[model samples]
Target: MNYLWPILILISLLFSIFRGTIQDINNSIFTSISDVVTLSLTLVGNMCLWCGLMKIVQETSIIKFLNKLLNPILKWLYPDSKENKEAMKAISINTISNFLGIGNAATPAGLKAMEELEKENMNKSELSNSMIMLIVLNTTSIQLIPTTVIAIRASLGSPNPSQIIIPIWISTIVGTLTGILITKILLRRRKI
Candidate 1:
């Protein structure tokens, strides 16, 4: 995977040079890196705020209450993970991060969940259904606040950064539902 990127970059650079678009390529690379750095800073700021909020929620037992409230749904989503508290904690944290629109913060938790899931698997090399479902959920996770989007809008000098809240909420909910449905259908088909 790492080698594939450098090869692709070399190919792109060669193509640009051949087409006499080296200047355009250079400008695009600079622009892309600048945008990445700006976005990274914004994400860091938003994630810090959300992580602090999460810590407060945890300290106040809000997270524990949420975990209890979500037990049924979690069971259905991760039937094989019933005995694993660490995996459940990681999943809960990942879910909280997604709900708060802190994708970067969610990554480590999601990775930990996968590692836990792998540990519990009998066929060590094969991913379980719960792992598959977790991946789908993470990919199309529903976000309420979309702090990242708002931060990007603010950074880009939007007139009203929060104006996108409703649209983002609606889209994320719908997308996540669709992803869940598709994953279930695929899993069912694979069973037969």
Candidate 2:
């Protein structure tokens, strides 16, 4: 998969060059580079804004309240982490940030959660059920807001960027739920 993307790009560039469209290829490459820069700048502002909000939430009582709500689910998924407040707290923040669709904001909390979870993993060579679940949750994050997508749409001049909120929420819910269910089922099978 890592080699596929570069190989594909190289093939496309070579093909275009061979077709006597070197100027077009050059323009396209530069244009893509410029677009990437523009997109990064756009995302940075949104990420910063959301990250600040997340920090404020973390500092407030709201996170504790959310922690309580999410605690049961985390406990079930990470049995050993039930007594680990640090891990639970990190998981809470990561989950909430992902829920709100601020994935950039979720990263730090996710990393923190993983680090804390790692400390509890008795066998350093193997991944725990909780760790696998955490990876699934982060990768297939449940997005209630999808702020990043909204930001991109707005940047592209969409008049109804927020219209996708419900769709995103629904999709993420299904995705997360399915991922968790599958993980749990597999874990049960492994135990047998």
Candidate 3:
């Protein structure tokens, strides 16, 4: 990521300069920076709201309930993962945040999940099975609420932002299944 960003920025700058659009490039840079700041501020509220809800659910028995509901599938995905309680809980929160469509809220949980998984890995050089599976799951997050997208659309003054729910659900379900299938096949191949 560190290498990719500078290379990308350099390329973009070169392309803009070569195109003789330095004025446009300067305007675009400032506009993009402004947009990013505005967007981050807007997203902060949604993230805080969902993270608060997650905390509430955790305090209640609801987190346990959700974990229980998700346990079977999670076990199937990574049988040894739930054996580590911390990793299991982190993964559950990560999944729940993803389901609620609060990707921003999910970041901390995902990072925690990765940290827990790394601990379980014992500083191994190679990625563990659970790590691979987690990567796959994150790539194709199973979105239930898509609240972030909806909120963004609403903030942009869309007439009916909720209209995208059905389409996104359908598309994401297919994508998640496909990604899992591919990941499983590749992992199996690696083992063999």
Candidate 4:
């Protein structure tokens, strides 16, 4: 992976040189740097805003409300960790963050949930069922809002950034369902 990128880049540079498009490459590099900086600032602002909002949600009764709503699904998804309050709480927070499409904000809660799950793990080196479920959930996060993507599109001067909402909903729902179903199938297979 480390060598792949440099090799690909070198090939691109060589191709551009041969095509007499080196100047175009130079222009693109400079333009891309500026664009990257602008995009980074926009992303940072959105992350900060959402993280702060998440903090507020955590401190208020909203978290309890959300936990109550998500409890049934969470219990079904994470049978092993259903009795562990800390794990359940962390999982709830991570789910809320992912649903809001602020994955960065979910990192802390995800890590905490992992830690809690690990405590119940019988084998020190092996993953617990709950841990695997958590991994699946995070990997196939089904976002309701997808705020980060919308922010990026809006920052890039999109006329209607929210136009992707329906597509995102469809794709994420399919991805999440597939991930969960596969995980369940694999886990069941392992048991027998």
Top model by lDDT, which number?
4
Better of 1 and 2 by lDDT: 2
For model 4 the TM-score comes to 0.69
Candidate 1 structure quality by residue, lDDT tens digits, 1-192: 589999999999999989999999889989999999999898788677756665666567766776787788888777779678778877888887778777877876787789988888888767788799999999888887877779999999999999999988888889988988888888889879
Q: Which stretches of candidate 1 lie over 4 Å from their true place?
A: 1-63
Model 1 lDDT, full chain set? 0.82
- 2 or 3: which has the higher lDDT? 3
lDDT of each: 0.82, 0.83, 0.84, 0.86
lDDT of 4 by residue, 17-36 (tens): 89999999999989999999
Off by over 4 Å in 3: 28-56, 124-127, 147-164
Ranked by TM-score, the better of candidates 2 and 4 is 4
Structure candidate 4, residue pairs in collision: none
The better-scoring model by lDDT among 3 and 4 is: 4
Task: Report the alpha-carbon TM-score of model 1 versus the true structure.
Answer: 0.68
The TM-score of predicted model 3 comes to: 0.73
Cα lDDT tens digits, model 3, 1-192, are 789999998998899889987898789889999999999897888777766776776688876887898898899888757798778777888888788776877876777788889998954987888888888888889888877789999999999999999999999999999988888888899879
RMSD in Å for model 1? 4.6
